[model samples]
Target: MRRALLAITGLAAGTTAMVVLKGSPGAAPVAQDLPAERPTVVPAPAGPTPSGGDTAGTPQPADSTASPRPGRTATRAPTSRPSATTRAPSAPRTTTKPPPAPTTRTVTGPVVENEYGNVQVQITLSGTRIVDVVALELPEETAQSDQRSEQVDGRYSGSSGLVVQRQSADVDTVSGATATSTSYKRSLQAAIDRAN
Candidate 1:
């Protein structure tokens, strides 16, 4: 096996060396010739050459009624015509929507008591829209409860409040703290009712 492997390695090295040396160094270099300049020759006009004027190959204005020169055909000028399919004039667009007029107000909710403790929330509104929801009180029966309440409140404080306000009291309860969510929503709904 070792001898076979050594033979394979030697074959690979020999193949690589042959490939590396395959290109011929004595190949002739390609010749790159510079482009030659050509003189510009404009064709003479069919009509009588203008005196002392260089109007060779210059375009002449079309004269449809004029007779064609000998051996040359007269070209007619193109006439403009209306399109076969005419588009109907577009109607002016109209909007009937009234502009939004937001009204800002702040209202506090009634305290809601659940199995954990009392929960109360204060809500800020702009017209019928709820702008912000703040917790006035939260359940904290024990030290652990207080810590859990703090963590839950921090997580849901802004985002959860916005959800409840926009979605109303029927929003989904927060995971791992259903009781807290229920109590908070109850209090928030009361506050929203007061604002309305």
Candidate 2:
């Protein structure tokens, strides 16, 4: 903004000076007749102009349109400005992703036994929330026990099961697997406690 302001001020000053100098008596001969449109012709600013500018045949500066009586003419060199400064590109920055999600891990509980058989629970956790549960061991001694165990596992274990949804062992027992369910809860609660 400052540079632009300075440039405008310089241009205005230069134009005013040129008009005063060119129109002043002794600079040129007075015209016997005036033209229709007095168009002001201004040159490239206080900047570089092409070399060999003045034609060898003409006495006046190339800017003048009239054939003026030959006299002394003066010229000054344009001022040069320093180019804008620039910095070299710096090394690429190293960016790192946030340490992976604290990672979900499975924690096993101490074995808990009941009349049915020994029960052990494994819970997969992320932070403090239970994400999944698995009954590592359940009674499979008899056909009835196997069926009952499956009922207990289906209701309380797996990713979308009661243990994970409730995020705790406080779940309703399966109809035919009371003892197995109770054992499962005890083991799951212990596993959760260890995780925390």
Each candidate's lDDT (Cα)?
0.70, 0.80
lDDT of 2 by residue, 1-196 (tens): 9999999999999999988767865566666653423333334345444468764433323454454334423233456866567556799999998877767788999898888789999999887788888889999999999999999999888999988888878899899788999899989988888988
Q: Which tens-of-lDDT digit does each residue in 117-192 have in candidate 1?
A: 8888876777776766678788889886676567556644564554444546566676767788888778878876
Please tell me which predicted candidate would have the highest TM-score against the true structure. Answer: 2
The TM-score values for the models, in the order shown, are 0.43, 0.50
* CA lDDT, candidate 1, residue 139: 82
Candidate 1 residue pairs in clash (backbone atoms < 3 Å) = 103-127
TM-score of model 2 vs. true structure: 0.50
| Candidates' RMSD to native | 25.7, 20.1
lDDT of candidate 2 at residue 23, scale 0 to 100: 81
Model 2 alpha-carbon drift over 4 Å, by segment: 1-100
